[model samples]
Target: MSESDLQDNNPLDPGDNSNLASGEGHSEDAPPFVPGLDGDPGSDQEEANNLEESTPVESDAFNAHVFEGQFEPNITSYQIIWQGSPNYWAGRGGNKIVAICDHIMQGSMESANSWFKNAASEVSAHFGVARDGRIYQWVRVENGAWTNGIMNRPDTSLPWLAEAIQKKINPNLLTIGIEHEGLTGQVFPEAQYQATLWLHRNLIQNYGIQPDRQHIIGHYQIDAVNRPGCPGTGFPWQRLLTDLGATQPKTTTLTSSSSSGGFLTGPVPGVVSGAFGPGTVNTNNAYVRSYPSFGAGVMVLRKLPAGTLLKFIAYTDQGAVYKGNSRWYLIDFTDKGGWIHSLMIS
Candidate 1:
């Protein structure tokens, strides 16, 4: 469908985004979970120190397109407009983009489109994906959009992120922001997911961005304090990472004993409880969502690393099944009940 047609069908009126700033489109109030990290607060300091000691790589080779005056659209198949008032001039010769970040409108596509076009909101993303998977670009890939507020700061704490920020490579300049139409923790439509996957593939290939967790992170990872549950927990991160051929890290074994603050670590030797059986997560970075379904609004509670044992307290026949199983198991994670696809559990 065309961009105008998609906007016309949006549920919210144009420029009416009252819920975006409220808790409507935000993720649940949960502690920040960084993939490949053990959820240790001190890890950030350690990483920062390591980055300080390492040699900084010159990004001159990555800026050839801007220097040569050759600009290519990241997604040529979508509709785009030069709504220039809301964005900033990306310094570093406009060739600093190296990552892709996702966000939820927490409202309607029409509202988001209008907001970016209004110039009053002072926020814009490079692309906006409608529920039907229609894509609209507000800013060119070469310039920085004001979608992410964290980009305004330079002293990022994460070691893997320190170098990028130190070189002024914030999300506004180094990442292509794509806002999806939906609330936080809601299921994202299949079409929208497909469109995002296509866009990501092109961006990764075109920008030479390493298809890994560190490079392609959610908004929460950038500024966990202010944007904790952005793009929410239900965003099938493992599936996307696997599809991108991103390198996987070795699984960390969870320790047994609920008293130790670990959920079920590994499978219980002899545990059986009808459909609510016990199983171990076989894949690293397996997602436990608030709902069984896959979509934009689906909330992810936590991403359990490999070998975390969990009990299948309940099951749902509905939802996407990656493996041969169509059932999703509900489990208690972090004192809250959440769902996970049965295929990821052993």
Candidate 2:
């Protein structure tokens, strides 16, 4: 997917060539076989994933421009799905395009090997989809990259949503929206949820976003005004909040019973009774990872601050803990280790 698709009004106008980075700067120049996803080991996707969405004032109005560094060499390849037309979300005359990527594949070969190279010929990169839950960005967050039009016509307004418009639902500037391929049906893949939380939390920290959660709204919540049942009813809303470390009213108390291998119990009460029984399996997909040192540590990450309380969602014998929507944290209890606090289990 080309970055040019995101421009409504280019603030830099550095010419088409400028935005297109050459071999030294952009990772697209690298061959499909790279070691890490972010192009470099130690190049934390969180650190290099700095997206600068500039809202420079011009002509008494705000002009938005999305400035981003090149993709990491580890991001082997990308499939541009649509380019000319908008996706299913953009009403009818929207300018948005969608792209799907295989981010966590092995050397040169996509783990799924299912490539839709021709997809971009039909749409733009207004939205991106990843097999994992992570959403690496390519566009700004303010302009209507073309998801939906504010003005349907000169006369007779199409009842354009005032709140949505005010929120700048433009696929161009206002959002860096992402769709997870594995999030089909009511359940999302364990890998997707964990990766998504890290991607989002990093984005929040990198951009210094206020309220943190405000910048990251789900596709379901976006069309809440006009469309109903968007993003589906089963979309993990609470998980998203917890993944981003955003605060919300407690819906249900997630408890970690000493039985059941000390796994975090589900919403139901007394079903498992926290017993470590036959069905209990130690897997990484069971919980969220809460890193205290931000982004450095063991197979999981780092430790949380002392006395920092975390809500527990589930557990995995894979040495990880899941706390929030997509928040999967590694469980550690060493001198350099950390602890995870649960809402139900103190």
The best candidate by TM-score is 1
State the displacement of the C-alpha of residue 193, model 2, in Å, after optimal TM-score superposition. Answer: 1.0
For each candidate, the alpha-carbon lDDT, in order, equals 0.53, 0.28
TM-score of every candidate = 0.52, 0.32
Over all chains combined, what TM-score does candidate 2 have?
A: 0.32
lDDT by residue for model 1 over 1-346, one digit each (tens)?
Answer: 1212111222211122246743332222212222332322224543243223212122243234122332234433433322323333333244556677877777787777666654345566777777787766665566556666643112132344667655544445567778888776777778878767766766777767788766777675564334534676556676788978898644322233342233332332212123344567655666676555555565565777667877654444334533212345657443355666654554
**lDDT digits (tens) for residues 140-191 of candidate 2:** 3422232222221111001122333454433223344443443223455665
Q: Which candidate number would show the highest lDDT if scored against the true structure?
A: 1
Model 1 alpha-carbon drift over 4 Å, by segment: 1-18, 21-85, 90-95, 151-160, 165-169, 256-346
In terms of lDDT, the poorest run of 10 residues in model 1 is 5-14
Error of 2 at 119 (Å): 8.9
